[model samples]
Target: MKNFISVVVTLFAVSFAKAQIPAGYYDAATGLTGYSLKTKLKEIVTNGHQDKGYGGLWDAYKVGDLDKFYENDNTILDIYSEKPAGPDAYSYTPVTDQCGGTTPGSEGGCYNREHLFPQGFFSSASPMRNDYHHVMPTDNVVNGKRNNYPFGTVGTASWTSTNGSKLGVSSFPGFLGIVFEPIDEFKGDVARSLLYFITRYEDDLQTFNYSDVNNPQDGSKNRGFD
Candidate 1:
């Protein structure tokens, strides 16, 4: 069943290879690739993106994943609970303390609205803070462990998710700092997500504090996967 699900997901991605944008969306950037192609996509997507509010994400982000989320399991495709590691998955119940934890910032106190991109680097600016594209649902404890660390291979795990997502130093060359490494099963999903954030926010990146395509914290480039 897991293999079947994986195949289905792969097919879904393959289908996207032939994706079409609305009429004339990239007519100007036809045949463009690399930086130029990305530039055009940035203009196209940014132009159409709606700056939704932070409050709206709870209701909004769960659109496609609600059914997939096992409420009793206390997760939303949680990497910490997948397997080969998961035993004590942090729950995602939202009724008690929303906006995540305010203190003791190392464990899951409430459902966490994680920024795929660190908010501190961006100074919690609007659109980025409110943008659902970059933020995601995670446990407050797991989220805190991830903190502002960049994603990379964890050679020596100081912390680990039940499913094997890790928080530690970067063993994956190019980037050699503390970083978060989601489990293998979710690596592709994470990559796709971060890429979308970069592509969608390319233009506005110049105004932000850190805009490096790789290692946004230090402007050092690194491979997306280990």
Candidate 2:
């Protein structure tokens, strides 16, 4: 029964025609290194990545939110959950396809797209706002709590998600400010998405409003803001 249940849930998720990078998409990136390799890789992703309109994400989430263990019904497939295998972060009974709700009172209210790097940081411009790599499934209330804050280690908790995620001052190196802190399990996933943003947009990164990148802020065409 357990295996049967997992199969059913996974099928539900896979039923969506999930967008994906094309085969041989990275062929051009082969044998490349550092700046040159990264540049080609950027071209590959930027050119191949289909820009699913911002509104097309409801379908996307259904496909992506399948990792939650079947045993944990309605529990978020949250990286912040200390008990990712079972038991919910909070009292959640997932409302089917009920993502991006206008107002969620708490954890289980609904899920929404969480911009790991934050779209506002880039001024909510095109492509960047709709990039699926940066946009991910998250509990509605928890997503709201994250707001537009950057992610980093938290020292004092201003607030805590039912799953135990927290928002507070930064303890990460080279910066000090309010930051969202997810569980350790999700750190690598978040880091990769952020790196993807830098790599894929390397050609136009400097144009974005944020100064986190090491590029010149001259607003050049290759400014990396796209």
Candidate 3:
């Protein structure tokens, strides 16, 4: 899963970097390295970003969240239930399978927008709450199980999803709260998504929730675990 997931993420990253970037988008950072490159990237990522509002995420999924890599059926690519090498445990149609007021008691019932950064951290503020880069369509029940927990390796899972994602106490050092661990197939995607979120919102991260004592912030603007 690590090798395959890494390849997939690398391909996606390379493709987006090469094709989606507008001409001269990185012209300012040409020949930059180290802190110079980092500063330029933050400038590039933060500028011209628009807030689409929370409702727009549902519409965005029709084009952005389809299962094009696996199953190839154009269903929602739910990380919590997707089996990359075989048929999924279940599938969801774009609009028809979206969650309403009631959430499923189990997996495969309906899908909802999951904030990879956890919306509560920022109090569900605009732009961050609606960002397509981190907000993904996922099984409602599994998303509830994830709740606001940080991602980590689980020691003993209290609950497991159909695709083997776990919700349990953390094996990661420093932090000892229950954490959600996605299957290995999606770890790269999750990591890259979080990196993008932090870079794009670097200016605002200091204002986010920071009540956890174990996870300390760097003296610089970036958040980190000590």
Candidate 4:
């Protein structure tokens, strides 16, 4: 019993240490926090300029020109390549027909960039906008199916995309299996992104959907679209 207890304690410590965030990963000086963060993001979308020639956040991230928060690398490609294996491995399938495609003359076959954090709610801010940590290339039709519905697990998908992605239900086994697809390498990144969003926008959290698992922190009291 004594040996077992000792091993358990050691394991717990190791897990906790692995999950700790490094200091300075999210400094405001990176020009992504406070008023500066807001100002630069506004410049990107003023006067419907974004809708004209703007290629969305993914295009901006590829060029490392998302407002002012530039990434040190092609973090999205790195994350996708390094994703985990087994049942948890990132699954890529054709999004359903309803979502459509972007490639010319291809009909609806290719995947489109997906924002794990939906663009509609954030007003498509640049800092969070082009972050590869949350952006995924998924089927465009499936994206349309998802629309702005809050994430959740269900027995059936209420809607299905052209390629096959569905918005009805999540198949994950977690307590609140709100299904989200993150590449294998970036599971930790997704978790951290959620933590950041919660902390930074703690005041507006309630406005968004809050599952027992997704938004576990309740100490702060602000809400966003749900």
How do all models score by TM-score? Answer: 0.72, 0.73, 0.86, 0.39
- How do the residues 138-195 of candidate 3 rate in per-residue lDDT, one tens digit apiece? 9999999888888889999999988899999999887688889999999877877776
lDDT: worst 10-residue window of model 1: 217-226
lDDT tens per residue, model 4, 53-97: 224544544453211222323232223223233221222332222
lDDT, candidate 1, 34-133, per-residue tens: 4555556557667867876878777764553332433334344445444533334454444444453365454445555788777776678888888876
Which segments of candidate 4 are over 4 A away from where they belong?
1-108, 159-165, 169-192, 200-226
Q: Write the per-residue lDDT of candidate 2 for residues 102-183, one digit (tens) a residue.
A: 6867566666778776776678887888887778777767788888777779998999876568999888776667888887
For model 2, state the Cα shift of residue 95 in Å: 7.0
Against the true structure, whose lDDT is highest? Answer: 3
Per-candidate local distance difference test: 0.61, 0.63, 0.78, 0.41
Q: Which sections of candidate 3 miss by over 4 Å?
A: 1-15, 213-220, 223-226
Q: Which parts of model 2 have CA positions greater than 4 angstroms off?
A: 1-24, 68-76, 80-82, 90-97, 211-226
Give me the displacement of residue 87 in model 4, in angstroms: 14
Q: Residue 187 in model 3: shift from native, Å?
A: 0.6
